[model samples]
Each structure stands twice: as C-alpha cells, then as structure tokens.
Target: MAFSSDLDQITRAASGDRQAVSALVNRYSPGVLALATRMLADRAEAEDVTQEAFIRAWKALPTWEPRAKFSTWLHRVALNLCYDRLRKRRDSTMAELPERVDMALRPDDALDQSERVQAVEGAIAALPERQAAALTLCALQDHSQAEAAAIMEISVEALESLLARARRTLRTVLMERSEA
Candidate 1:
C-alpha cells in the first residue's frame, strides 16, 4: 500500500499494523532528526532525541487523534522530548571554561561560511528555550504564526510576541558578536 495514504497507515497502525508503523517512522524520521538537531544543538543528543521521538510516536499512535496533521503532531512530540532533555541537564556541573577569543568573520570561502553558520547556530543555541523554540517553529521551519501558535499551544498573539522577542534577542546577540 502507498504510504502517501498516511491517514490510512495511521489507522492500520492503530489496529496493530507493524509494517505501517515502520512506514510511519521511515517517512517522518528525517524531519524529526532535523528538528531535534536544531533544538538539541548536539549531534549525539539530537540522534538520541530522534530515536526516542519515534519510540514515543509508535507507543502513542493508538491514542493519536486525527485532529491535526500527522507531521505537526510529530513535530510537537519531538519538541517536547528536546525540552525534557534540556530540563534534565539544567543543573549539571560545567567543565573548565575555554578562553574567549574574537574570531574574525571571513564569509568569502565555503569553510568560512560554514564557520559563520556554526557561530550563528551557537548563538541561537544560547537563546532562552522558549525564544529558541519560537524562532525554530516560526522562522526556521517556515510555519505561519497561527500554525506555530497551534503547535506551541499558545494564542496567535502570544506566538507573535515570542517571535518578536526571539528576533530582537537574535539581532542583539549577532550584532554584539560582530562588534567583538
């Protein structure tokens, strides 16, 4: 059967179709990994989150209602898993600090572009969790404000506020780093 009929596959999986469940995982795994990587900021941790998300999605499949898009539901699940991991690591002791050095921006070459991207990613990673989440959902993921709000379980106005704050914070952080 074509997996494009995702709703049917979901129904079959709900009725205990193991292959259908596998198809669901196969279909959504890449998107889950991308989202996890952006949120977790560590490749290994993102991998773990992606695996855990699929496991949770499979286990929760029976109870999943068809109210929202399946991808949207999966995104929410992955995001929540990332949040849980962040909470668990909140109080961990830090290793010795590395000396801060102002790195020059060299965006001409591909390597320099990659480094610049990584620096920007690091800045985003340092943002407050809610701000990062909001930016990820609305800006990076290209979701509309209303859709992002629905995924975040907040009102559209609240989502817009979060997006505004995230953008302002990112601009300030980037500008400060550039001036350094």
Candidate 2:
C-alpha cells in the first residue's frame, strides 16, 4: 500500500487490467468493509456499502488524479456513502435500532472475551458519527494521522479532538457496562 505501488496499480487498473483490479480489491476491500461495518453496525448493509464503494472506485479510476492516496480516496468515498445511508435511515419513518445478540460461549474466559468485544463495539456504534470514523480510521484501521485527517476532510487537530472525545465516551460507556 505504498504510494508508488498504489499509483502503479491505479494506472494499470485504469487501463482495464483485471489483475490490477483484483490486486487493488484484495489489498483494500477488507479495510473498506471493516470501516463500513463499524460505521453501519450491520453486516448486510456494510457489505452493500463495500460493493458500492468499489463500484465507485472503478468508475473514478479513469479520471483519477493522484492528489491523494488511492486508499484515502477510496475510504473517503466509502465514508460519504455511509453518511448518505445514515442520513436516509434517519429520515426514514421505519428505521429501528438493531437488536443486540447474546453469545453463549461455553468457557467463562471465552464468554468474558466475547462480552468485552461486544461491549466495545456497541459503545463505538453508539458514538457520534465523526468520532466513530476518527477512532476507527486512526486506532482500529491503523491509518496514519495525516492520512485519516485527509480521509475525513478535517485538520489533524480536529481529528485529535474527535479521537479524544471518542476515547473518553467509550471509556465511560464500557466502565458502566463492566460495573453493571
């Protein structure tokens, strides 16, 4: 995912090279899917968003300029798509929150681990959208601070602020859950 490799792949893919396309997809799809899943909190909707993001990527390739890293651009596209879906859901009269699932693990250790993961994820899903995106990109997805800020179209300071708030919120929520 280096700058040069992305440029090379984008050039080849833009020329309709199937191998290049596959390589790009294999490299980037997981990150895209993970981001969408975290943001949407629905596997099916996340999958749809992932597919649509790639489709948009394919369409944009021909006219793509290297103003930003390909991954950054792709992620930005996916984030915007998530925003659109979120807005639509907010506007819809029938939208309802998804129910939480209980995982019944046999071992106490495994159950504790699963509950911790679920608690963190649920807390994240409940965060403000920008905060969630900031945390997901910088912490979970391991994007560089500059790259993440670029993706979110915000300043590094703003991103740091969002990350701090997100961490504080997650800490408070998870602590309450653990105490309960």
Candidate 3:
C-alpha cells in the first residue's frame, strides 16, 4: 500500500523512473539551490552541491522511508554537502564576495552598501556550522521552527537556542563593523 499512497511518485523514482526523478528535481531544485547558496555563500559551489544532493537522493531512493517529508530529507542532504565543502576549505578569504547589484547606483552609496553586505555575510560565515544552519533555515528560508528543527535533526528548543546565539553574534559583528 505504500506504493499506492502519497509516495507513489517517490516509489516510481526509487524504481528508476526517469519521469519521476525529473519531476522531483523540478519540484525541489530551487529550494535546494537556495539552501545551498545561503549556507555555502557561493553560487557556483551551491550549484554543484545541489546537483550532488539530487544524485545522492536518486541513489538512496531505494532505501528512502516515507516518514520524513522528501523536502526535509533533501535539505538535510544538501546541508551535509555544504558542510563538507566548508570543512575542506582552509582560507578565510575563500568566502565569495557579496553578489554585485545590477541596479545603477551612486558611487558612495554602492560602496557603503557593498561593505555592509560583505560585513554581514562575513559574520554569518564566521558562525558555528550548526548555529548558522539553524538561522539560515529558520530566518531566511521562512521555514517554521518545527520544520527547521526537523531539517537540522534537533529539537525545537535547541533550534531556538542556536537562533538566539546566532542573532546575538550577528548583532555584535555588525555593530563592530559600523564602529570601525
């Protein structure tokens, strides 16, 4: 009956149906890409991580359980890939600069905005992996705390603690940036 239920699509994907795989990719790729980009802070790396995440999902589909939502499983996979890359990288300067704005802007204003953005990004990059992941999922992605906690494989209370710590760290970092 599992194959006849809400997971019929995933059942097909598990059995190596290209159409099911394609459908799943289309439905979830954007979210995976966003999570990877936000977590890694590197669009190119994020794209690679996204691709790898889907490939892994495809491989693991045979063993996939229906308990967790597919999206949550995929996010966890993507976060793990992002963390792997984060671990292997050594140089602090390796983090990508803030994305360039396409809008035409005054010279001084652009400079100011760019600096502020970079400072914020740098602060985020400096956070502990778990805390940063918690904040990224809950705050930026608009995921419910319950959902984010599930994705991070932590209790909701722990997620709240991480969020508080990450916020305090971000505040201190930004304030220091402004003062300097």
Candidate 4:
C-alpha cells in the first residue's frame, strides 16, 4: 500500500539516509509548525519548538520503533517540546501570553469569524494543559477519539471524559466572553 512506502521512507531515514530525512522534514514540517503554533500561541516560540522538535526527532530516529504512524510520532514529539517550553516558562516566572489574532481588517466578515477564532484560541490557551492537549489533538488536529487517546496515553473512556470537560469549559468561556 502507499502508506507502507511512507513508512519505508521513515525507516530509511532512521537508518541514516539523509535524503530521506530531509524529505520527511519537508513533508511534515508545515504541519508540525501549525500544530506548535496552535498549542503555544507564540509564533516565535512555536518556530523554535518546531525546529527543536525536528532536531530531536532526527536524533531519536534510530531508536524509533514503527509501532505507530510517523505523523503521530512527530506530533507527540512536538507536543512534548511545547509542554517543555511551557514548563520552563512557568518555572522562570515568565509565562508567555497567547497572541490575539487581529480582526480589524474585515469587520464585515460573516459571524465575526476572526473574533470568534480569537476567543476560542484564547479560551483553549487558558485551559489546563491536559484539557488543551485533548482538545487540540482531537478537535483541532482531527484525530479520532482512539487516536487521540493513544497519543495521550489515556484510556478511551478517560479521553472521552477529558474531551467532555474541555468542550464544556470552552463553551462556558466563549459564552461568558460573548456576554461581556
């Protein structure tokens, strides 16, 4: 199958095929950057995390077992790096704030789409890390409940519980902001 060929490329990269590794980087870097940006909310920090994640992935490739999809593995790496940066910031008393998406350019946009996006992102950023991770992995990243649960190392039922709470909290936050 076509999927197996992609997996072969990853395996080849793991075996020190530089071209294969570079190709993998080219293929997955954008997605990684997007995911990091969504999770971290700071473009510069997200870029840094994205770079570090690739470096880490390259270093760890030889040890990688092809048990899961390569993209899934890469996502886990990116998520771990984001959490590490957040933890470091927390320890240093320098928690970075989420960036507000600009909405001034298109005031007539349907349903105030820009404002809603900013509000949702802000609410997600304010969530507890686990809840945010769950929402990001499931809702934003389009991972199935099983896949998200697998990535989070939680049981399916536990993931469902987390998803429920995350959605409820997000709704409350958005509604409260709308009422303000």
- Which one is best on TM-score? 2
User: When superposed on Cα atoms, how far off is each prediction in RMSD?
Assistant: 3.7, 3.2, 5.2, 3.6
TM-score of 3: 0.77
Ten-residue segment with the worst summed lDDT in candidate 1?
95-104
lDDT of 4: 0.77
**How many Å off is the CA of 141 in candidate 3?**
0.6
Weakest lDDT window of 10 consecutive positions for candidate 2? 100-109
Q: How well is each residue in 1-180 modelled by candidate 3, as lDDT tens digits?
A: 423442777888888788887888887899889888777777899999999998998887888787787888889999999888887774555755345333323234445686556555556767777888988898878678877998889999999999999999877755665555
> For model 1, how does the per-residue alpha-carbon lDDT over 1-180 read when each residue is reduced to its tens digit?
332487888888889889988888788888778767767678899899888877777777788777887777777888889888777777574522212224444454344665676776676666777777888887787667776777777898888888799888877776676678
- Listed in order, each prediction's TM-score against the native is 0.80, 0.89, 0.77, 0.81
Q: Score each candidate by Cα lDDT.
A: 0.74, 0.86, 0.78, 0.77
lDDT of 1 at 122: 70
lDDT of 4 by residue, 56-167 (tens): 8878777777788777777788888888877887899866666544333223446577566776677787777778888888888767887777777788898888889999
Model 3 / residue 102 / CA error / Å: 20
Q: Rank the candidates by lDDT, best first.
A: 2, 3, 4, 1
The backbone clash count of each candidate, in order, is 0, 0, 0, 0
Misplaced by over 4 Å in model 4 are 1-3, 14-19, 94-111
Clashing pairs in 2: none
Give the clashing residue pairs of candidate 4, or none: none
